[model samples]
Target: MSGAIEFWFDFSSSYAYFAAKRIDALGARVGRPVLWRPFMLGTAFRETGARGLSTTPLKKDYARHDWARLARAGGFDFRLPEGHPLIALAATRAFYAIDEDSPAEAARFARAVFERYYIEGLDTTSARAMGDFAAGLGLDGDRIAAACESAAIKDKARVMSESAVARGVFGSPWFFVDDEPFWGHDRMAMMEDWIRTGGW
Candidate 1:
């Protein structure tokens, strides 16, 4: 990949969670750097008139079975954390804080929040949980916690959500090779092929 691939994700989306763990390998194969951008799905949905997965019985049912299939196919241990819907705006903004510190590690930190709420049945909105999650990533716990509460980061998240709207993104795990957007993990292979053949 001569340029870069943008991966826009939301922490609470099951598909985004799955893609994050595997897209890096796909990028490596194509010789491209993955530019991870975390955004709020709720904002995107509000603007685009899309609904959350949990609210859609058909999609939610499909996801329920699909997640099990994915776990087996990908050889990753899978467990649905809880039934509570996650509000990811704060956590998504927190990603920008840890991003420059370490992109790979930052992704892990964001994923930790995902796992905590989605897989471990933990209440991530708790101040204590956020601090503990930050500490686990070797980040300054207090600083990260404070940053999450900052108006600046909150604004930053709003910007990212608007940016996604501008980019015509309506969902999570959206990948872009330049302006060409790929919307699902299944398209990851095509992303790799595009990179190897020199970006389209």
Candidate 2:
């Protein structure tokens, strides 16, 4: 591979959680590093006029059912969270703050957040939840909790999200291998094929 795979994801996206669990191994197998990009989806939705699949009438019903099926197939233990979509702003800001100094730790924190939200059904939208997760990673919980509300961290998260939107990303679990774009966990096979065959 000539370049790393840019994995753009939102913490509230279950599909992104599935991808996050596997992207690193997939990238390693193909001799490429996965660049984890965490972004807030609220701005992306506003920019693209896109709504969540689970919020769209008939699609919402199917999505709830499909989420469980996909989770089972992917071997990811999932429970429908009490609050389906929690505001991801604080958690996202925390991610960017950690990512700025340590990408690896950021990845770990991201996965932990996903697991906490989906499997454990915790309300990870809270700054306290974010701080708890960060503390587990040996980070300063109070500092990170404070950072989540800081102007600098907030702006960083916004810029990262807006930059993704500017790059034509309007969905969760979106990936770019160099200039090639792929979307959704369902497209993982295609992405792997593209990596191996260098695209058609």
Candidate 3:
């Protein structure tokens, strides 16, 4: 009970998208609400000295086939976002830049970012797209630009990424229950089982 499950994710994570659809139900079974911690997996890689799946030719090939198979099986839509190595720095900042009174709005904006990249082929790094995305999220577009420029938000993003590494997370879609880290969207069943048995 003392340790909450942290969901460390980024916008471009395809598997993260898959997990997001299912994690809430798993958390509900455990009487725990998953804390959504958005962090840049790219940042985590840079800091932790871990290379992305693009490091090896074989790995990249496998990823393509895996995603295709998984996407088809799950009936999930597949579209590559406009920006692969996107700088989500500003977007992350915008969420933290908003005032406490606007938390719900901020969350909506964050969710939009995810949907933009994972579900839609929008370039999230584009200012115009971000402005529109913010507007769609029930936030004032003017305020979105200001939030994107906040130093505090950038710092928070960095801290969140570091925390993900500290928690032994080396990639996207990391889930934790108590001190146990579950890496990958496929491991959700394991987490669900653990939750059902009350610490099995």
For every candidate in turn, the CA RMSD to the true structure comes to 2.2, 1.6, 2.6
Q: Model 3: which residue pairs collide?
A: none
CA error at residue 25 for candidate 2, angstroms? 1.7
Number of clashing pairs per prediction, in order:
2, 0, 0
User: What TM-score against the true fold does each predicted structure earn?
Assistant: 0.89, 0.95, 0.84
Model 1 alpha-carbon drift over 4 Å, by segment:
100-104, 115-118, 126-128
For TM-score, the strongest prediction is 2
lDDT of 1 by residue, 78-183 (tens): 6776554667655776677677577777767766776666557655554446766788768777777787788877787788888987888888889889678888
Q: Candidate 3 lDDT (Cα, whole model)?
A: 0.69
Which segments of model 2 are wrong by more than 4 Å?
none
User: How many angstroms is residue 120 displaced in model 1 relative to the true structure, after the best TM-score fit?
Assistant: 1.8
**Clashing pairs for predicted structure model 2, backbone only:** none
Ranking by TM-score: 2, 1, 3
Q: Is candidate 1 or candidate 3 better by TM-score?
A: 1
Model 3 residue 148 lDDT? Answer: 61
RMSD of 2: 1.6
Which 10 consecutive residues of model 2 have the lowest summed lDDT?
120-129
Q: Candidate 1 or 2, higher TM-score?
A: 2
